[model samples]
Target chain A: MIAELVLAMLFGLLLLGIHRKVIARIQRRPGPPVWQEILHAAKFSFKTTWVPATASGALFAGIVLVAVGIWTAAFFVMMTGGSLLIIFGIYMLHKIVEHAFGLSSGSPYGKFGGVRSVISAASEIPLFVSVAVIGLFTGSLELTEITAWEAVHGPLFFTAFPAVVAMYLVLLSKMPFGPFSIVESKELVSGYKTEHFGAWRAGLEVCNGLKTTVLLATFLLVFAGQLPVLWMVIGMILLTVSLSFACAVTPMLSPFDSVTIQSLVTALMLVYAGIVFTGVLP
Target chain B: MGSLGGIPLYVLEFGDELVYFSPYTITLFLLALTFTLLAIVSRPERQVDVAFGGDAYTTKIISVDEMRFRRFMAIACGLASMGAMVTGDVFNFTLFTAMVGITNVGIVAAVKSPHVQDAAYQYGLVALSATVPLFGAAALYAAATGSLSMIELAKGTLPAVPLVAKALLVIGVVGEGMAPFYAAKAEMFRAPGAPYVIMCSLSSLLIFLRVAEVVMIG
Candidate 1:
């Protein structure tokens, strides 16, 4: 279990690093190596660390543990093939964690980032509906059962294409420079993360890595069914590259527009779910 | 999902009130407990408000009275969410969910800022209206199924839970604190107390997850 977590952290950071490299190439800029984020976590860990006097010291510090702890739990949930509801719940809770990160420090920029994270809550709603769609199709909500169902009935991507698209959009929202990622847009100066530094920031990085890994692997497992470890890694990279391409080509939406587009996608998905639930499309 | 590990076992029960903690609820319960514990022991952060286009900034300190009240509300919100996470009856879930809504509004209602107060008032109105559908769904479940027990409902032996009731449950939850109505919620988060304000969001998310599992299984 420990090895799996460590591997997830490292590989997730590598995927994030490659994501930057891909976007840079698309934009005709040289990007840092794929190890940059790993190095970033290390460098931040070694830097001098102190809690800001203006900050709520305990929450400002403790929120980082909550952030990492929830994601670690999410990692374990996926590892055990428990339930998609738990995984998505933890992901949505991260929004609150982001808000806490910003508010705990009491920084205006961080506050704006945190507020944007709250607005971005629409992004995660689609994942719940995706879970609903998958459950409707597969007759089960556990990953183990879902994969087994897929093995017997072919991939859910074919049967539940709208859900696949919704899940893909959910993935895109979390990509660093995506049009939907207004929370981390350049104006906020690292957004919710601006207040965290040193070890705290390192912990956040670790959480992000684990989150990216869990989400990517989940999409792969749910939509494509089970695969060998090597194939799973390859699939995750391909998925990350596609998300990177989307992030690189489009400019970040204004916060209002970002929320608007996500809400619209959610509406579309809801309509699709309604149709499926009512036997209109089945 | 409907059921973790595709099994059901009530961990504890007393009379009509009981608790069931699937692997799913266990995580949520732990998370709520963790946040509540933080609220109990931590001091509120002094918020830093910056003057745009300049380096000047000032820290806003929370007063003792405000801290005490908001801490109580936050802990109440956390405990309510924990109840929503593990309760065995549909009505109990709704009751816990409604309690969470009330406490969420209370969490920021003490702030001196008119902005947060105004947001809290509006959110309170929405939350008040939400309980209409929330209690209605719970009542509808008992009427249609002849029992409020989730274990009975999940057995698939009771008259199939009405799709309208399920939809109503989701609607009630979304009304409590989902993103579409998050304009007010975002404003509420603008209040200075970090540990307390976050409980509002965490509780809603937990309740939503639990209800998702509830509706799916029923």
Candidate 2:
């Protein structure tokens, strides 16, 4: 568990650096220095914290802590011998708490951010379903069980290719690229994190990095299973690159359409059902 | 695509087998066809002008390129739907369904005029209505079967009474569909494009609830 936690944190920090650099390159501008995110976080951690007059200071801080706490917990859950359901539950709780923290801020931007958070949370379903489907195929949601299944069966994606594709889409929703990135765009001015600064700002950045790292890690665990440690590291690096590229290339799709959501739900459901009927889902 | 995140169970089991389309794929294809046909055939001669009402709002119309992007997304949806059908894995199928649903919502939002908030609202309602009962049925099924494997359920023949129950389940599904429409209409009065964001976010919950039902009931 300790090893996993350490590995997860280290990997997360590395990805943060990679994400910054890659995004910069994509934008065709001199991006922040590779270590800029780390330096910024360090600076903020040392700065004095601020609280708005109308805000619930303690609650605000508490929510941030909870967000980080849950993120950390999710990492451990993934590492430990827990079921997939437990890991997912932890993830959902973390997101909910993060949103609650956003709501604690009194600013209108903060309120809007909170609302966006709710919207983003709602968008998590298809991805969750994808994960659940993978669990079902293995006859166990336990990581170990899944890994063992992978080793013996040689990858569910090969047999259950549709699930693999679905998983990829779910991954997209979780990170929310393209049209799904409605929660954190500049229009909302960082959405929930708008009012945070100094150490709070730093904390959020670190948490965001951690969140991304955790997500990547979860994806790896689900898709790659027990690879050699060297392979794992290399694979993670590649994933970071891919994500950076994804962020760079994909047009940011607006989340302001009801039809977009409906379409996603309907399309995914119909396809899933069709797979079952055609004997592809087992 | 790499195994660093740990291999998914399906990957471990199947290992690069060619995925095939199934009934779910057909449904998505049909839906996509219907939508495309609607877009092509029902190109309204006069686009509705955005009339600012209630609170003052700023709205930006999506560009033609964005419309193309929606079509690209639709293609992705169709492909995902086909893939899910081929896999015969319930979890994958459900996930792809949700993605396609969300993508469709995005496409509709992009094409429709801001004045047509009612259309958006109706879309949301349909999503909610469709999802609720689908999930409810899944949950009931999971509980009755003592397993969450959708494949198992798919293979097992259902009793006639249960089939009726499942048919009646459409009511809740329809309610799921109606939810976004109402939500879209409500948001139009506040933020002009609020429905899009709300629907995107809701997609996650809707899919989650449905899967939870399947896991619990199936």
Candidate 3:
């Protein structure tokens, strides 16, 4: 399990590197190398670290561990094909981690970052909606059962298209440069992460990598059903690349606008869910 | 026994209520446990109000009186969340969820910041009103079917729970979670004490997750 987590962290960071690369190429700039993020994490870890005088001592430090810990458990949940509801729960909890990251340091910028994360709770609502829609179509909330249903029938990707779109928007919101990622917007000077530095930042980087892996791989596993490890990795890369292209072409929306768009997508998902509930989507 | 790992680890029955452990609920319960531990061990941070983006921090330490109150509320919130995650009866789940809501508001009540207080006040109103649907849904379930037990409801023997009752349950859970859930609720996080403040959000999200399973299973 440890080895798998380590590999997932490495691979997840590499995907992020690729995300940066894709974004840079699209903008016609020379971005850092694909291994830039790995080096970044290593570089941060070697630096001196300390809790800020004004920060909540234990929380300022402990949130990082919780940040990494939750995502690590999320990775195993996906790996073991646990209930999809557990994954949904963890995904919602990530927002709280962002809130804690921002508020723990008591930095003004961090507080606003945390506040923005809370206001953006609309983004995760569609996650549960998407989960419900999938359960509605497949008649089970178990990941294994959903995959089995897809094996018997074709992928829900064809039958329940809007759930896919909703999940994709969820991925975008969490992605680093995506329009919905107001929490880490540059104006807040790294946003929720502004107060965290050194080994703490490295811990966050590890969490981010695992998060990227679990979310993308979960999306693929759910929609595409079971696959060999290589196929799954390849699919994840493709999905990340596609997300990068979206991030590259678009400018970041204002925070309210970001929420507006996410809310709209959620509404659309609900409409789709309503249609499915009425027996119209089959 | 299966690849999809929601194996039930243990079941404890007390008189008429059952609290069981599955891989999923245990994960949530452990999270509440960890955060409660944090509340017990951590000191509240002094909030730095860089309202002008400069080095101006309020520097006023969170008071001892408030600290004890918040710690108490945080632990209560955590325990309520842990209960909401594991309860086997539908009405028991609703009661635990209501406790989570009250404790969520209580966690923020000691902030002493007018903004946080106002947000908590509004959230309390929503949470209090949410109980109508919450208990109402449970009553509906008991009326429609002869039992309020989730295990019994899941057996496909008694009359299936009405769709309206399930929808009402979801509505109630959404309101209970609305503290960290809505745009205005963000203001409550402005309260100091990240460790304790976090219990408010964590409890809401966990209960919401549990309800998703409740509606799905029962």
Candidate 4:
């Protein structure tokens, strides 16, 4: 488990660097080395990290720990091939962590970020719809069961392609620089993380990297299952690169716009899920 | 009528020695209990004396008396939510749902901002109107099945309910701020106290969860 966590964290940070490099290259600018995230972490570890005086002291500090804790648990779940429902639950709870991060800072920027986070939770509906679709297709919510089914029946994407797309969109919304990155957009002066500096910021970056890693890994295991370990890792990197390209091409949507788009997607996914649930598709 | 930690907790008086503790009720009860404890223990978002981006206002702080009252209302809301969750009878569930709405308004009514007061007023009016559908659903259920007890209905003692009653129940709960009706209560979150404001959202969520369980299981 410890090894899994360490590898996940490392890969997460590495993915983050890859994302930056991808976007930079897309703009024809020289990008930092792919290890830039590691360098940032090392630099921040040596610097002083202080709690803001204007902040809600306990909550401000606790939010980072909460983020770290939840993502760590998510990492554990992914590594152990635990129930996907548990993973989805943790993902839902991460919305609370995001809201807490913003609200605890007592800064208007943070509050805005928090509010955006709340609105973005509506995105969960579509994700839930996708989960239900996947569950219907596989006859289970357990990752092991889904993977086992995939091993015998081939990948679910071959049949439940719409659900795979829905899940992919949900993943896009979580990726850095994705259209729904309004929570930490530059317009909000880094938004929720505005007040979190130094080591706390480093902790958030690491958590973000872990979240990215877990999400990509989940996508691989859940949708593209039955691959060998070498192929699985390669598949994950390809996914990271594809997501980075998607992020680079798309501009961030306004907070309200993101919510609107998410809701529309959720409505569509719900319709698809309903059709599946009714046994109209099989 | 059951005992928890040696303290008798009244559920529904179905009859002598016929207590209801179904999995549906248990799930709602536990969810409410969890959020209630959270409302009590979670640290609130701090409202600072300073403002940024040239938007300046006097530092907003609730008086000790008002804070006490808000906390009381929040706890009351929590209790009402839990009540709505665990009730075995449809009428009692609707009654508790109405109480949850009332206490939800009361939780945020103490904030002095005109915006919050305006939002509370809007919510209060909606809550008042929502009771009609809520109680009407219960009445419809009773009239349709000759009983309002979910346990009795779940036992196949009653016929399946009219679709209208189910729809009404869901609409009534939604008007209490789930999704579409959430806009009415959005401004209420502007209230300076996080703990109290949180109850407004939490109660609605719990009630929604309970409603989903009730609709499917009952």
Candidate 5:
């Protein structure tokens, strides 16, 4: 567990630099150098911290720490257990904690962002149910179990093809590409992070990096489990490249009106359920 | 237990020691190259245009109110998708996908017309009509096949009952995809090309769900 945590944090740092570089390349500008992310982290540590007059200082600090700490811890746990259900629950807790911190800041933007986070949380239900269904079919909730089943069963794709498609769609939403990026739009002037600066900002950045790494690792452990270790590493690298490409090509979606998001989610659920029942997936 | 179809649940036998080979590594590298080439060469042009150039058509700046709505939906879609994908459950996967797709289409349609209210009503009706039949078909398929294993049906080696069931499943998948496209068109042509918002949300949901499903189910 200790080894996994260390590895995850290290990988998170590495990916942060990679993410910055990729974003820069995508925007048609020379971004800050690769080592810039590390430098920023170091700079943040030395910077003076501030407390809002209206906020509970110790509580505020604790919230941020708890949010980041819990997420990081969850990542390690996920690596060790390789259980899909447990991992999902931990990540959800992480998200909720982050939102709490945002709300604690007492800023209008933060409050609104927190509300949006709740909405996002609500939308996750169907996808959550879908994955549970997968567990039901495979007769196991452990990541390792699913992988072994796939190896023995010759890929669930042949049987649960629609479920596969649905899974892909869910991935797109979770990583929040394009339209799903409503939570982190620049126009909202940074949304939940509007009031945060200096070290707090830096912490969030690091956490974001960690979040990215965790999601990537989870994706690998879930989908490409049969790949040899080296190939899994390669796949992670490939995923980074793809994410960069997606960030470059896709426009940010607005989150002002959730009706569309809700409708799409509903439609997807019904369709996916229909497919599973019909037995047409192969 | 007696062997079913002459296959054992566990087999533990090795003739050779496990070792990493540099040549095998090179083969993977080569395979990656081929995969990239294929992805680039066979890329669909329509998707590229929609993804990269859709913003150019917009004439008005998005209002703050609109931005808020977009943010709400994006986060909602993103979280929902993430949750479903990670659950690694079949039911959650299907339910989330359909929900995300329908909601996206409805929103797009509602925003696209001079009469937002009318558009929403119409879209809602359409979604209802489209989805109900699909569900019925799927249920029928499930009943006829008498086999609950998705893996077997996907193999295309299922008995007669399952074959018909599988055909219905395909229709349902295609229908879900259509809801978003229709919504996108409504947002683009009727509204102010706000389909990108719906599309992005759907894309995020789709990607997370796909990777998770593949790992868990595949």
Candidate 6:
């Protein structure tokens, strides 16, 4: 599990680097190297991390630790074929971590970011629906069972494509450059991380990477099933390119617009779920 | 397990009339209890100060009477939530849910802001109205099974209760500010106190969780 987590972080950071490179190329600018995130983390680690005088000391100091811990647990659960219910629980807890990250800083920007996190709670339902859809087709909520089913019946992506779309949207909302990235947009002065600098910010960056890796890995696991190492890396790259393309083409939506889009996706998924539930869409 | 005063420490039974504690209830009970403790301990001192027509930076301290009342309400909310989770009787669950609603109002009632007070008033009305459906669901179950005990209901011996009754139970709990109803309580969070105010969210969440389990088991 520890090894998987460490590899997840490495791949996560690399994916982010790939995303930046792709976006920069599309925008006609020279971007940082694919290894830029590693360098960035190394630099931040050398700086002295300090809590701001105006911040809520305990909550402020605890956010990064909590974020890292939650994502690590998520990775562990996924790697071990543990309960998907537990993974869903971890995902919900991560929302609270975002709220805490913003609220703890006592900065207006952080507070707004925190409120945005709360507003974005609507996105959670679609993810839950996606889980239900997967459970329905696989006849189990355990990753082991789902993977075993896939081993016999093949990837669910062909049959459950709508759910795949919904889950992808959930992943998009969490990733940088996505429509929901407004929470940390430059206009908000980096939003929740406005106050957390140096090592703390680095911790958050690492957490972000881990979250990305977990989410993408989950998508692959459920939709594509288990693949050989070379094939998995190829799949990850293809996914990264597709997400980057979407990010490049789409403008950032207002929080209201983003929620509306998520709601529509959720509605579509629920309709699909109803069909499946009614035995009309075998 | 070990014994505490001649009663088993791990499981508690009271002839099935009062409450029963098993591994499931104990797990969720401890979860709610721990969050309540954390809510009390993690009280943030920065209070939101509202200004009517002038400077907003002027500092003001919460009055002792108001603080005492808010603390009392918060503790009451916590205890009521604990009761809702730990009780074996469906009627008692509904009763404690109603208390949770009342105390939710009490927790924010001390704030001297019109907007917040207005929201609290609205939430109170909605929450109070929820009791009809809540108690009605329990009553329907009792009528169907001749017993309101969840242990009995979970035995699967009685006729399956109507779906509407289950729907009523969920809707009543949702009135405690889950999802669509959350808009009514959103402004109440703007009240100055963080620790006491968090209890409002915590209690609602716990009740909703317990409702899910109860709905499933029963």
Model 4, C-alpha of A123: deviation from truth (Å): 4.5
Report the lDDT of model 4 for residue B42.
51
Q: Write the per-residue lDDT of candidate 3 for residues A143-259, one digit (tens) a residue.
A: 888899999999888878888888888889889988887898999998988989999999999999999999999998888999899999999999999999999999999988988
Superposed by TM-score, candidate 6 places the C-alpha of residue B205 at a distance from the truth, in angstroms, of 4.9
- Against the true structure, candidate 2 reaches a TM-score of 0.60
lDDT winner, 3 or 5: 3
Considering only N, C-alpha and C atoms within 3 Å, which residue pairs clash in candidate 6?
Answer: none
lDDT of 6 by residue, A1-282 (tens): 677777788888899889988988898889889878867776787888887654556556655776787678678767877656545555655555666676665566675665566567645544566776776687665677788989999899998898888878877777787777867877778776788888988898789778878888778888889888788888888898889888877888997787778778788887888788668323
Docking class of 6: incorrect
Question: Once model 5 is optimally superposed onto the true structure by TM-score, how far is the C-alpha of residue A247 displaced, in angstroms?
Answer: 2.3
What docking class should model 2 receive?
incorrect
User: Residue A151 error for model 4, in Å?
Assistant: 2.7
Q: What does DockQ come to for candidate 2?
A: 0.03
TM-score winner, 1 or 4: 1
Model 4 TM-score is 0.78
Fraction of native contacts in model 3? 0.72
Q: Number of the top candidate by DockQ?
A: 1
Docking class of 3: medium
Evaluation by DockQ, superior candidate among 2 and 4: 4
Residue-by-residue lDDT tens digits, candidate 1, A143-202: 899999999999998999999998898889888888888787788898988979999999
Q: Comparing 1 and 4 by DockQ, which wins?
A: 1
Q: Which model, 3 or 4, shows the larger TM-score?
A: 3
lDDT of 1 by residue, B6-25 (tens): 35444688798878877778
- Return the clash pairs for model 1, or none: A56-B45, A106-B48
lDDT of 4: 0.72
Residue-level lDDT for B169 in candidate 3: 97
Comparing 1 with 2 on lDDT, the higher-scoring candidate is: 1
Ranking by DockQ: 1, 3, 4, 6, 2, 5
Task: Answer with 1 or 5, whichever has the higher DockQ.
Answer: 1
